[model samples]
Target: MNEEFVLETKGKNRLIISPNQYCFIKLPSSGIKIVQLRPDGVISLGKFGCFEVNSVLNHPYGETFEIIENKQARAIYTDAFEAGNDDEDLEEENISEAEISSKLLSTDKENKSRLDNRDVNDIGSGVQKLTSVEIELLKKDSELSNKGKGIIEKLIESHTNFNKKTVHSQEKYVKRKQQKFLKVFTIEYLSASNLLRFYTSKDFGKIHELSEESLGLMISLADVRPGGRYLVVDECLGLIVYTMMERMNLQGEIVLIHENEHANLISLKYSDYSEEEIKKFVKTINWLQFFEPDNEKIKFPIKSETEISLLTAQKRSNYYRHKRNAEITNSVIDNVKRGQFDGLIMASTLYLPKLLPKIVDKIGGSRAIVCYSNNKELLNETNHVLLNDVRVINSKILETRVRPYQSIPGKLHPLMTIRSGGGYLLWGLRVIPGDKIKATGRGNKKS
Candidate 1:
């Protein structure tokens, strides 16, 4: 019923960038940078540029903007023409076949009256004539003006054989230059896929190299949805919890078990869900308390407000603290004892053989039990144990990967390099076993 909870429940609108929501800024050359949109703040894009948060406050996601500096205020270019009026305009209107052919020729041949037959070494940096110092000066000037078109044009003019490359090669060269000098960036909403991408670029180890596809599959195989109670053990810095929450849409409850005294849900802080919203859905308890909660040791009588007022301040504080802990411990123990969790999901480093037996019974009958590990060997070991257990059925080990391709027109091909692994999943269904059958001397019979 809270506004933050409702917003996440109903899904965010792509047309508006909300305050405190994580979003992606697609840099011209640096891929994407994920940033939270803080109100009335400045987002510095390093050497590219900086702009006020208000510039993109209510703009639609997926729209690109070019940052431009102003003495009085920061400005952005949203239209193509506003970006530049030099080579881009020329390329559109004044390109000729003869010029393209000439550009494709060698620099020495281009200097002649016509194309000449001569071998030319093209591997080195002999095409451009601008000195590093001069280029840096141009970059400084462009930064001051908050425009890169002029700098790119100047570089192209300085190229010794700008008119000697093929049309496609020329276009590629221009694009590369633009990437180097352009101050443009695109805004994207922070979905699961985007978040994974951001983290993968920053630090793959943090999320255990979990890809977007693998994550989606894990959630689907676990049957995570609204109104379901899930027992989760997340060791990927709360990535699994965030994904589950996205799928659940703030509708269900998550009983999270952690190895530490306090759960390390650091990743969730960057998520769009507020603290209140997350508290409503996620309940965390340490492994010790979850497995061996001493409810009686912490139990105490609930004191009335008037009665507590009579006690000293220090005593009252201690009493309330113990009461809170007791309530939390009791709640966790009661939920585990209920034995009605719809699913059991874990992505921890603990031995699955030892861990599963301790918590597998917490899941309800005909429910899912999914465990994810970056190493296949770990899942393989878990698979064998789950297959032998009578309480689990249809155990399987699965791996999901996403192959990337260079999508250039007329030159499409698989990328030469890509992230090698997307980790693996161990899946099974929890079931209730019936009475066991006993064998007689010559025939099978019930005991």
Candidate 2:
């Protein structure tokens, strides 16, 4: 119903960059900026460069673009994106040992080789001859390949200790310089994982410090699918909702019950889902309305058919709009009363021990109920509460840790620095409290 929601898209290709849609640009400085492409508009990346949005509208995502001195963008292959490209560029200077050698420059490869960085004084020994203005001039030179090899070659030639440094140190130096003056950027699709990463880098606390790996694991454990109906309570700023929508892939229905008077799902705007899709799949209800629909009904002005006929065209249109909305609200309440949702997922800061009993019944028997929190103690208390409650079965706390390793050959090991905490998850299944169970676990112990 908002003007921001449009029925038609500029392009049908999801992989290709489309105009008027939100996409992320990964800058040469390792920073990301989200932008909405407008027709014939220019995209500025500050010191890196600027280009027309139409220049990349038809191109596929993940392709890198370099800014020429003329302020135009050209698609080019970067060393990071394409393997062996760095080696090929550096091979002429005879310093192309291997791109993988850079990772071991710190502390990993001294056991295997004698060429370590012990004698390398990168900070003081090597002095760069090119000034800031001269470097800018080189970036604008249209004669170069626009692949940034020219600038790097110049930098290596200008350094006094270019040959004194080992292959590892040399590569690291070039890589650092490349990140600064390449004037390059890549466009990405902005999927759920990418969205989570953007938030993690910008404001981790805003999303309760939830990691992508943990979020994916929770969704998998919940058995989210295209056709299943689901219930959710999110306090992570529509993060769970967006990820759930990604898993649902524009199918089925998700009923989100919020504790606040209005849902602040501002991040969902960049999800690229049309208004029609969101309106159809995601049904939002107030906490009170969900718990007591009769007492907190979605109210509307009552007008008889005869009374409506006496009004003008504008009043008649307004009346129908309000009538349709109220009808939809009442219908959602009626359906929720039918109960038996496929699953219930929560990522709120509320007290779970008392909250679970009230909403767990909405979830169907044998279905999953997953809760996420920044503190493990909250889930631990919930686990204790559900341990004896017959309404739930197999309640337990879960945590998924993803250890990332440095992706360089011959230096393949986990990175010393990593993300410490991604929070915890509590999992359980809905069950009939009155039902008598013959056995609860292995060995068939009767309850």
Candidate 3:
């Protein structure tokens, strides 16, 4: 009986159990698996249903979860992993509102008994019931896609304790972390500036640059305000998005123009808001994806008749109307020049000095925030380009590192391989808007 716990994997690529907490479970039988929760919950994949271990939580950590099928007609349970085959099915079928509502309700008494018998304390000592309204909200939000809805539906349908009240309460609890201005998506432990300051104030760690605190530092430095338009690029699992969502007013919008399929925007899984609330929150931001063509591409050469031409007939009497606007290739640079953005934030591993200028050109009168790796060549080249451009006001590089504290003196372990660049940041703003200083006729004017 060690403290270690077990998790099962399902057909999904990953089932987000907690902000940072995750475990991949391998099925002993079929390929179909389920991702088990550390404390209690278990999310099934594909056709398989899911339930919690609250009834079994009191059992020892190493205790195996048996999915024994009853001879009587009740429910079927199995351990198998489908290679995201369900995702393809999800894209094809559109789940009805009726089905969503029905799935949100709880399962039968037998399942309830099973849940009660499981380790309730392990499920979470603070777990509370969710209201019907909250469950409805979750149903709505969980409707991201067929697969997304199915996951939520299966969870509630199998677990008796999982009602609207519990779902809603859990959502509130999970989402509350966003309010505290901390990154929820990090796998590695990070020391943020605010947290570091707290540590120093409490005499925890030696005063040094806190690498883990970069997000807090960047947020503070950017000075993001209400109603400000920002051009941002971050692969840090939407930590920046969560921070912005918390800091920004209701009217604020964060346009995420990303290249990756599973960017920070898609990775946002909330436990606080119901599926509906999460969907509503997701709808607020504009996802200007470069790869996916969920919508027809906005054609180039803006013409008056182009809008009408863009409208295609879905059937004899129906038509598929699309918004025909400037393409990203043609209009992105121009959009930056029109002063549409209040600030610019770009964080990526790729070096885009040549293309970045185009991005900066569009940023008229806004601060340019760039994040780079420890590799000086890439950053140096970018720095040179920024200096050449008159719009760039000032530029500096900030470095951050995390040092473990209060550890046993002789404890030793192998070093871990972290993502390259070790969190290096490059920040700058527009050069213009300043009073001209009189020259003393000695040398060139200082910026």
Best by TM-score: 2
The top-ranked prediction according to lDDT is 2
Model 3 TM-score, all chains together = 0.41
Off by over 4 Å in 1: 1-15, 71-127, 144-146, 161-170, 295-297, 304-306, 314-318, 437-447
Put the candidates in TM-score order, highest first: 2, 1, 3
**Lowest summed lDDT over 10 consecutive residues: which window, candidate 3?**
180-189
lDDT for model 2 comes to: 0.74
Query: In candidate 2, what residue range of length 10 has the lowest lDDT sum?
Result: 1-10
RMSD of each: 6.3, 6.0, 21.1
Tell how far residue 275 is off in model 1, in angstroms: 1.4
lDDT rank order: 2, 1, 3
lDDT of 1 at 194: 75
Tens digit per residue, CA lDDT, model 1, 153-185: 787678766565554455556666667777777
- Judged by whole-model lDDT over C-alpha atoms, candidate 1 comes out at 0.72
Candidate 1 TM-score over all chains jointly: 0.82
Question: Which wins on TM-score, candidate 1 or candidate 3?
Answer: 1
TM-scores, all models, native as reference? 0.82, 0.84, 0.41
Give Cα-based local distance difference scores for all models.
Answer: 0.72, 0.74, 0.40
Per-residue lDDT tens digits of candidate 2, residues 7-117? 233233459888887888887567888888897999888867788888888888887776664556777654453212323233334232222233333332233323655
Error of 2 at 398 (Å): 1.3
Residue 354 lDDT in model 1?
Answer: 73
